[model samples]
Target: MKVLIVDDELNIREGLKKMITAFCPYVSEIGDTYGVQSGLEAIKKEQPDLVLLDVELEDGTGMDLLSSLDVIDFQLVFITAHNKYAIDAFKFSAIEFLLKPIDTDNLMHALDKAKKQIGNENLAEQLQILKQSLNAIRANDKKIVLKDINSIYFVKVSDIVRCESDGQYTQFHLSDSQKILISKSLKEYEKLLEPYGFIRPHHSHLINRHKIVRFDKTNGGTLLMETNCRIPVSHRKRAHILQVLDNQQ
Candidate 1:
């Protein structure tokens, strides 16, 4: 896969290029550049599968590049010298990071993680992360867009109670006693929402782990939800469903 290495320092840009060549044999093309301006130009030109971005740059910050982009359609792995910004990476769902003076071992580890995660190349998801990165400084939770014919609503991930699959679309149960229709398949929602705590309990149902009230472990297992709707735990998910619930407590 193509990889773009973006950092302000010449040493790091060269160091990581060598590390990728030595460790990640799967990497086909490597593009290296310094500063956010050149990095953005490189990104627009190559459109690589993965981006190893530094937090700081000469012309501007990496976050600035994120802000200016219409959509980020690549897997992002951050390389930074500051520990303070590291904590915020999780909020934006950054794949991994490298500290100052890159270590070969850590670089390999981070590359492995990126290769596995982005191998599938879900372009919708790539755009979603770009949207998320732009919203990092906000105090509110992350959101996803649902377009119905008349209206488009951005629903917060945290406010989701559960998702029920209809014939052609999925319905989102929210905490505010409102139901919204997302014109997308349940499988699509499953892949998108899995990063959060949403899991498939039945063929037609995806439950939010944070909203579970109780579970009955009998042959016909039942799930009591915080919304007061008791859902059935499918036979296939019985063992894993209970295990996840146990771990949650």
Candidate 2:
């Protein structure tokens, strides 16, 4: 596979090239470019299969370069500095990214994932979600990209009624009765969704506060979800959950 590295810093570009050469056996040719304008030119000329794109450029941001292109046929892996908002956007979009001063293990993992999703038609959709999340003023306006083994789902945060932990996987119960099982841990999502009013009432369940129909005190404490499913509120969290519910009232 042909690859392109686009970054303004010469050292970053060179370091990435050396790593790719040493580790990525499938990469046949590698090209390098600086800034958005040159990066666009290189992409058009080289027609690379994969691109390691930096978020910021001298001329413009990487998103600007992508917007200029009518078609995105190449797999993408974004490189960004330690910016929380940008990281959150990437996470929401389910796109692969490597932090500044990249780690070899992380780079290898990102490349492997990019290689697996080479021909995925959902790239554009994922980029759109990323852009939207970055631009959105309200957290509820942001959409999350969830990928199961068979399908990718772009779901609104408000539509999620609850998430149930299943070993290493998390099952999302949506308001429209659609369920999506993602290959990620509930603990990972707990950190992402908690700011949006999702409460971890039990070790195995994360509940959306707005989606709770009622709090049933029977058999200890339980939450009646909007989907008519009953979720247990653990003894440890029962007091905190009740306090939150009371405050909401």
Q: Give the candidate number with the greatest TM-score.
A: 2
Q: Candidate 2, overall lDDT?
A: 0.90
lDDT per residue (tens digit) for residues 157-242 in model 1: 77888899997799988889789887788999999887677778898999878789888777679888889997888888888898
User: What are the clash counts of all predictions, listed in order?
Assistant: 0, 0
Residues 1-249 of candidate 2 have per-residue lDDT tens digits of: 889999999999999989998998988999999989999999999999999999889899999999999999999999999468779989989999999999988999999889999998999989977876664424566698999999889988888899999999999999999999998999999999886778999999998887888999879899999889999998999999998888555
RMSD of 2: 16.4
- Listed in order, each prediction's TM-score against the native is 0.48, 0.56
lDDT (0 to 1) per candidate: 0.78, 0.90
Q: How does model 1 fare in lDDT?
A: 0.78
Worst 10 residues of 2 by lDDT: 132-141
Cα deviation at 100, candidate 2, in Å, is 0.7
Model 1 clashing residue pairs (backbone): none
Give the clash count for model 1: 0
Pairs with steric clashes in candidate 2 = none
